[model samples]
Target: MTGGRLRPGTIFGIGLNYADTIREMGRETPTTPYLFPKLTSSVIGDGEAIVIDTEITSRVDWESELAVVIGETARDVPAAEALGIVRGYTVAQDVSARDLQEADGQWVRGKGLDTFCPLGPEVVPAADVPDPQQLAVRTWLNGERVQEGTTKDMVFTVAELIAYLSSFFTLRPGDVILTGTPSGCGDFRTPRMALKPGDVLVSEVEGIGRLTNPVVAKT
Candidate 1:
């Protein structure tokens, strides 16, 4: 059932979807979901190495999130029926280059680096995930438990996201939507956690499986 790996399609990502994360950063709740794109070239499957070019970015960080996979062609989907087009759920790490993200003011370059979007170990069918909003998500950096939260904290629900996104354009099968990460991302940590060579990052969602990746120095 792990056939959840994203295929030929655009993967959309959302920012500030988690309410606690917004509050933790002292930001206002978003009236609509803030969106971004993790270019398809940035995708890596489970166990793939997340290569980082230290020269280009000294602040590569982890943002574990839940990813929803599209099962059918959809357009102008309604929130009440959004989940109908979903194929399954998976895990993804929104690996970010914080310096570039904050300095550039736009997220494309900061979030679209090759291997920046670490995708699934497997996709769990939507039928199996009765309530995506109720799932628990966690992130582990190396052996340390760095983040733990539940989807219940999301400011925008998954169904709402689907409906909102499809309203703009058609969402095809295999397209993915990264819901958002929790408040424990590396950039917000006390000492500021960052990804470096030899670090293993594990992202997990309750219904979906975990994605485990190792950090490597970009040659």
Candidate 2:
């Protein structure tokens, strides 16, 4: 709720939703969307500091994702009507502790850390974005563009994702679905790129505003 609105309900995340990103990480394309939950405590607004636990981990990576905010409850909704339930869209940086993520065999511990999820400069109303599927998304670290892609590359469209998700669980108002990031993540690089104490990560979605934040070591 960075745009002067109250907070939402549960926030859902769809992992590995980008095909190129999956291939870059040397993983096979998922037959269905991979889902995860981000605790509300983990969410922080743009320009906030993303605290890194230097003692436990030395490698942290940035993932830029498009977040969908739900406006109504939906269960077993059809893809055709999925967009109708959306309230707005925002940018989210899925900051990850790679070591913890790999060691745990699941994303919860690695992704659920405090300040791991940085969301928004503001939420753009859904009415403003005619096609969420065609927007461009990019990520920059210290002013250097690292990730660039379009939602058209998404393995599953936002509407399709909503339909697929609603088939299992009920989606309520304020619930958010973080669409996955594209290729060029630090962990997928040849030498592996990790966030440093002074690094700045910026994520931007076309039409949606940009979100910038500094990386700091945990006390």
Candidate 3:
């Protein structure tokens, strides 16, 4: 199934879950998970355009992330049982408005903008992805690779994140966890290469499918 097939539910996002990414940004590893939320309104199916709102912010960036789809109701689950509730996985692009994100001092508006989360061409069932931590996540902009990393580099594994999240709330069906992105994001690049009009970005996660989105100016 594609993202368009999902039912309305909560979407939790993990931040600073990659040690190398944290180091790349000159931050320390979190003692606890840094969590964020991405609204369901932000999600769009594959092959959609990621509109860059230049009027609101000029520094639009792209992040390739692995999205976990919950299959069962889980409350205070342990890591050993966390993966049992997973329905599948999907590739997602976490588009961001860097300037607005920084100015607002929170990720709600910047990370939850409409069309900011491009998810799924299809969902690969959890059974198909035996080891989520071994998957590779890559981002390409304008036919050139910009970011490449393996889930093994993640500071927190998928099961660990699920267990951690379930400790605080019930994770029901259709809830998605956008596991944090890796390093090589534009935010840390020299000369600051950011998304502009007329750019196509492809977010790929191994074992799942890819999402190709063109960047366009806001209407």
lDDT tens readout by residue for model 1, 27-69: 8888999999889999888888999998899999899999999
On lDDT, the stronger of 1 and 3 is: 1
Give all TM-scores, in the order shown. 0.96, 0.96, 0.96
What overall lDDT, based on C-alpha atoms, would model 2 receive against the true structure?
Answer: 0.89
Candidate 3 C-alpha lDDT tens digits along 1-219: 543544438889888888779998898899888898998898887777888777788888888999999999889999998999999998878888888889999899999998898888777899999899998999999999999999998888899999999999999998999999989899789889899989999999988978888888888
Worst 10 residues of 2 by lDDT: 1-10
Screening candidate 2 with a backbone cut-off below 3 angstroms (N, C-alpha, C), the clashing residue pairs are: none
The residue-level lDDT of candidate 2 at 194 comes to 96
Clashes of 2: 0
Best candidate (score: lDDT): 1
Report the alpha-carbon TM-score of model 2 versus the true structure: 0.96
CA lDDT, every model vs. true structure? 0.90, 0.89, 0.88
Which rank order by lDDT, best down to worst?
1, 2, 3
